[model samples]
Target: MFTIQQIDGAHAKVKTGADFPKYIQEIKELGVTAFDFLVSNGVEVYYGEEPFKTNSPAKYDPLNINENLNAQQFAKELKEHQDGKTDFPYFVKMCAINGIASWKVDLEEYTCTYFDLEGEEVLQEEIPGE
Candidate 1:
């Protein structure tokens, strides 16, 4: 179960669940007001000043995992891994499949915080804030 709130005229808050397909349909009808979407889909949202770096191979990546590994084998592998490791990549892959290319990080305190590919905080001294 996920909750969705239409905050402003440009953005909408989206959570993840079985209701996502429905939520997206609603948001499309209602019109999103916020830029970031304030997505809290029970998945740890990563923040960066710029867009996420997507690989070319990942761009045309097939959604059907059975092509590489059978469904049962994929399920077994996923069950063995810990949380937050494979989950994010899986979510990214799903987003990509749906043509959701870029995502922005909306931090209340630091609106323009920069993060490296490894998701580490980077401070710029010449940026006036630092």
Candidate 2:
């Protein structure tokens, strides 16, 4: 099961277990695009420091899975992307299809966080000078 919360006026957050694909399909059934739904639902951002560039091929790659692919197939594809076995272009397409704009994995906590398009965290190192 999955839970969705509104983060703010323009964002929403989602929490789920291993059944992320089911929740994604649910969101799609709500008449909202997966990207918009995930973004509005506040999916956690991953690799915030190195945001996907607007002109990157990955940003525009199309999802190529078979139309008849099942939830398991979706999950498998997403897992492969998460494992870094896929290229950025493929990852981008996967993200678009899955509505996972940003994500972060916490090894210590054994948790994953997903954020919306606007939820990406900007990393800033503190400087000595004020």
RMSD of each: 16.5, 16.8
Top-lDDT candidate index: 2
Clashes of each: 8, 13
Candidate 2 residue lDDT tens string, 32-55:
222322222233322212232111
**Model 2 regions more than 4 Å off:** 1-73, 82-85, 115-130
Candidate 1 lDDT, tens digit per residue, 1-130? 1123232221232232322334334433443221231112222233223453211112233333112223343334333332223443465454333333234333323232322233334321111121
lDDT of each: 0.31, 0.36
Clashing pairs in 1: 9-33, 10-32, 10-33, 10-34, 11-32, 11-33, 11-34, 16-41
At residue 23, candidate 1 shows an lDDT of 35
The best candidate in terms of TM-score: 2
